[model samples]
Target: MSKLEIHQIPVLNDNYLYLIKDPDSDAVAIVDPAVAEPVQEKLDELGWRLTHILNTHHHFDHTGANLELKEKTGCIIVGSKADADRIPGIDIQLEDGDIFEFGTQKARIFEVSGHTLGHIAYWFEGSDALFCGDTLFALGCGRLFEGTPAQMWHSLSKFLTLPDRTKVYCAHEYTEANARFALSVEPQNAALQQRFEDILALRAKGQPTVPSTLGEEKNTNPFLRPDSPDLQETLGMGGADLIDIFAETRARKDSF
Candidate 1:
């Protein structure tokens, strides 16, 4: 296998569209192309042809460019099998545990339903990258739009099984705001405090705080720390079930 290169393209509001390429083969795939023009521009700039479009869900912001990009680049659209009907121009339907290969890169799909029931994340183990669309964020998790709190908990738990060094490539740049909410829930956490300051500086400079490692998120992300004594105490849910604690934390974030 050859080394893969991933480029982050900022799109609508805070969304990020990734351009992944296998340098050896010159094969490229676009992840969640929110729009067609910018993606096409990127492909033109790189002088690479788009071979595939990997969509994480059916959200308009994520798949809005599916048809146009496919028509323009003749790329095969790939998405969750569960969302085939909702995903525009889907040519390849993937399910949990499916292995999708392009050039020298292989990605394992994980059906992490929470933000949406059909939301799936692509983990390119060879590249140490996880393209998690909305299921997990920098410091927070996606809103419970279609799944239950328990289901979201289960979905997020799956990420814990990955290597701590895995780089998380989430779909949005919501770290700054998420940091604020995290601090509210774990005010006494020194790790969370330092992370908030770091996020503040990064956002101030118009820098991206994405591609955070799983290790960093496990230590600082409140959504992934349901067992933290400090967070449990802050929520006044000490000794409560982890799922309930997680549910309470999510609810607070929703209203935060």
Candidate 2:
């Protein structure tokens, strides 16, 4: 069993920050820290020293605490080389395919852009975890803020290369609303219907619905299933260009 401990810290209206600890070496890292206080409090509670800060993009919410946390903990910050100029206090700039060693566990970086032009995900191979910041969500994707539908599609498609059981640790709690859009586009998908029900129940109980499995997302997420017949038909883009189908679905969701 993997001993990589990940603690979820919810902050400021729907954001999820991951505090990850590697058991073998006491290496601790927090992914996309928006606020400094909660992270610092958590560190004190666990009596663990923060070592690194992992950022997937240059968004303000993701990098807000970079300076404070670095000064407070003397933690090194890691981010994409392409967007290093925007990432506050970034110490190690990495590009796609680079390996980031975290104590005993390591993450293979995948530059999954489109949420932001330089957004990247850290796929911890042996840990069965993917810290995908804002590119892919539970059932939806990030809006095309600085990239195109084609870029987002290409970015999301990389997840298909990952193992079925890989846990997708996206940076938000958007599953319930994303499910509504997914069902509207692919109502015929039994798996998606059931997932929607499950999402509603989870949200109703004030629980998180993130970290959905790659296999489950591939089987149900409409954004990931643009080529599926039901979703295509629902969008009236039967046999349309794959990107076109995805674009239309995303357009509709933008208004949703």
- Backbone Cα, N, C clashes tallied per candidate: 0, 0
lDDT of 2: 0.92
| Candidate 1 residue-wise lDDT at 16 | 97
**Candidate 2: segments with Cα more than 4 A from true spot:** none
- Model 2: per-residue Cα lDDT over 123-144, one tens digit each: 9989899999999999999999
- Candidate 2: how many backbone clashes? 0
TM accuracy, model 1: 0.98
* Model 1 stretches with alpha carbons more than 4 Å out: none
lDDT per residue, candidate 1, 59-130, as tens digits? 999999999988988899999999899999999999999998878788899999988998999999988999
TM-score (C-alpha) between model 2 and the true structure = 0.98
In Å, residue 54's CA in model 1 sits off its true spot by 0.2
